[model samples]
Target: MARCEFCGVEADFPFICSYCRRPYCVGHRLPEAHECPNIIFARPPDHVRKIFEGRLEEPARHVRPVLTSELKQLLLAWLVLGFCFSVNSLTAPQLFITTLLISLGTLGLGFIGHELAHRYVAR
Candidate 1:
């Protein structure tokens, strides 16, 4: 409910200027835009400024590895499922191997596809 000090317009959502501690609308929120008196406060404190400056000296490490921690559990689960299917399918010698393989392959695909769909939807 605060009004923009610079524009004198009532701000529905105010952005409080860190430097001057004055509420402003998005347009006049920046210290430069509002002609903030205490522009020196715009710079971060020495310790924090030093930490950020130090980081800039080193080349950024941007290699983000994809997580595969659940892979072992997923593979183990597929093995158990395949074994169960194979055991039950032992009665038919000719069609047993083909049926088990095809079913397990499709089941794994379906499971992976379903999980990916859920992830995308949530994201």
Candidate 2:
């Protein structure tokens, strides 16, 4: 049974917001005119707290379209860095330091690329 997100009362007929798709029981649900365009309506915070249970919980699914592409591009970029790190590891006396620096730089680039993909592809 759908319940009000805010007050936790059983809902007669929950309204699923077009943006976020969270079920909101009527009384707890804010009226549409008051909602912000940038903010998708969500189940009450307590509901999400119950659903997630912990701060470390992973999202149920990777619903974003860019996640796959971001991961693929990040993998390829890191693969190239791995090759370079391997070469440096063989030749350098300070292998650990160089590897750490290169790894951090690669991660930074990968994050930037991921953000770019999301920005370009997001609706």
Candidate 3:
């Protein structure tokens, strides 16, 4: 059986501290409780910490547009059209030359419509 590194109590299932590489009981499992030596090295550098703290102090600036109901419908239409085009093309190859041409045309139109919808929604 393994033992807790801090309190020396027998532990059936000890939690391991990642930094110090020591097994500890639930009560002293955290790095701070055990006073882990590697805690100093584990911290981010001063500059990186300052940048993160600065961002937290600032309010959100940008208001990005989310996907509305119309955008969702347009995206769904593109997905369904693309699926149909794929199925038609695969089946059309075994059918006839005219069928193949028609499938190709449908696929092209679907691709163009999908691109146009994407551009419209983005703007």
Query: Which model scores highest in TM-score?
Result: 3
Indicate the worst ten consecutive residues by lDDT in candidate 2: 42-51
Candidate 1 wrongly placed segments (more than 4 Å): 1-67, 118-123
TM-score of each: 0.39, 0.26, 0.41
Predicted candidate 1 versus true structure: per-residue lDDT over 1-107, tens digit per residue: 89999999999999998878899999999998999999877867664233565564454578645656565666667766766767767888767788678767977
lDDT-based ranking, best first?
Answer: 1, 3, 2
Best by the lDDT measure: 1
In model 1, the worst 10-residue window by lDDT is 47-56
Candidate 2: clashing pairs of residues: none
Model 3, 21-62: lDDT tens digits are 999999889888888898887677664323474565444478
**What value does the lDDT take at residue 53 in candidate 2?**
53
lDDT, candidate 2, 85-120, per-residue tens:
556576665885677567757765775677678878
Clashes of each: 0, 0, 0
lDDT of 1: 0.78
What candidate 3 gets wrong by more than 4 Å, as runs, is 46-81, 85-123
Cα-based lDDT at residue 97, candidate 2: 63
lDDT of each: 0.78, 0.61, 0.73
